[model samples]
Target: MMVLDGEELDQLYVDPSWQSRGIGNRLVDLAKTQSPTGLALWTFQVNAPAQRFYERHGFVAVEHTDGSRNEEREPDIRYEWRRGPVRP
Candidate 1:
């Protein structure tokens, strides 16, 4: 996982075979710890599983693009996360 511009999360990936195994959870948690104020990242629109994963981790979809800004030129969604209220 890489944090860009001090607050953007990039290149956060786990091998497909390694997915659904909590590695993602750990990485996201670590990202939160490192970027407690806020964090943002983009994922292809076709990656529904990734979108769900980030949503479960408290990220909310805030913007979408027609693949114009990225090199791949694929439709994408942007998600943002902020430190929420304490649970207890």
Candidate 2:
């Protein structure tokens, strides 16, 4: 998934059988590289696993919507990650 000007993450998915195998983390790393300043993504609130995975990767919950705007009408949360200062 690619977003210009660090706007958002369009999509990131791993096959269910490939989950828990670090693929998602690698993809997240790639996204960070692609958007060096930051990246944001929306995920369904019911997806607890996705939330945990994003949190573990340094993403913080920034906002939430109550199923009003989306076509699916499912509550969702927005998470963001900003590049931090480099350490020696």
Candidate 3:
């Protein structure tokens, strides 16, 4: 039940022990139904694994957003998915 910007999915975590069991995929699928077009999320620029997962789920890198907040910040990447069509 976590949400962001009233239109995004954030911090979707499956227990480390449950990793790779397709639980995360299922949750993402569920979230898609509730989202407009589809979901969007941000992950650390270094998290290649997560970026791959999102790509498998049909997300594409739209841009990179500021990771700054009063000095405690890190680079983050923004990804988005469209349940409809992808514009070129």
lDDT of each: 0.88, 0.86, 0.79
Clashes of 1: 0
- Collision pairs in model 1: none
What lDDT tens digits, residue by residue, belong to model 3 across residues 26-56?
8788788778676788888888998999999
TM values, all candidates: 0.89, 0.89, 0.80
How do all the candidates rank in terms of lDDT, highest first? 1, 2, 3
Candidate 1 vs candidate 2: the lDDT winner is: 1
User: RMSD (Cα, Å) of candidate 1?
Assistant: 1.7
Q: Give one digit per residue, the lDDT tens place, for model 2 in 45-83.
A: 999999999999999999999979888999999999998
RMSD of 2: 2.0
Query: What clash count does candidate 2 reach?
Result: 0
Q: After aligning candidate 2 to the native by TM-score, how far in Å is the CA of 8 from where it should be?
A: 1.1
Better of 1 and 3 by lDDT: 1
Identify the superior model by TM-score, candidate 1 or candidate 3: 1
